[model samples]
Target: KREFITDDDSSDVTGAHVSKIESTIMVKTEASSVVLTQQQTSHLNHSQQSITTQQQQQQNVHIKQQPQQHNNIVQQAHPQQ
Candidate 1:
């Protein structure tokens, strides 16, 4: 009966070790997924910033052209060129 008790104790210890290994693996997988989400969010933010910059550049070009158009109109009216 003593030997049977010893065997049961060893089995319980082995079962606990297996569960610990499983939990560690689960934690590692969760951490990697979190990292992936962070990377995706940053990438999306970069794309949005680039889109806004492009829009600002376009607005600047339009503003620059308006003055040129006014100069052309003035020259046509005065025949100074």
Candidate 2:
């Protein structure tokens, strides 16, 4: 069997779940009737932010900090090493 999801004219929709029982495919995609709580939305936002930050950090290390002003600065900073 095959199933499809569509953007109906319903705005109060929430979760679209599908389950198989015996030889029948049950698809419940009508409406949520109840709005999602604020906690759920906040959790999603937090996860997205963390992912974005981690990606940015992995992009560059010392490429973001300022470089030495002149050769003198470099010599003064690292004399032996």
Who wins the lDDT comparison? 1
Which candidate number would show the highest TM-score if scored against the true structure?
1
Total backbone collisions, model 1? 0
| Per-model C-alpha RMSD | 21.9, 19.0
Off by over 4 Å in 1: 40-81
What TM-score would each prediction reach against the true structure?
0.45, 0.15
lDDT of each candidate versus the true structure: 0.53, 0.30
TM-score of 1: 0.45
lDDT of 2: 0.30
Backbone clash pairs for candidate 2 read none
Q: Tell me the spans in candidate 2 whose CA falls farther than 4 Å from its real position.
A: 1-38, 52-81
lDDT of 2 at 17: 25
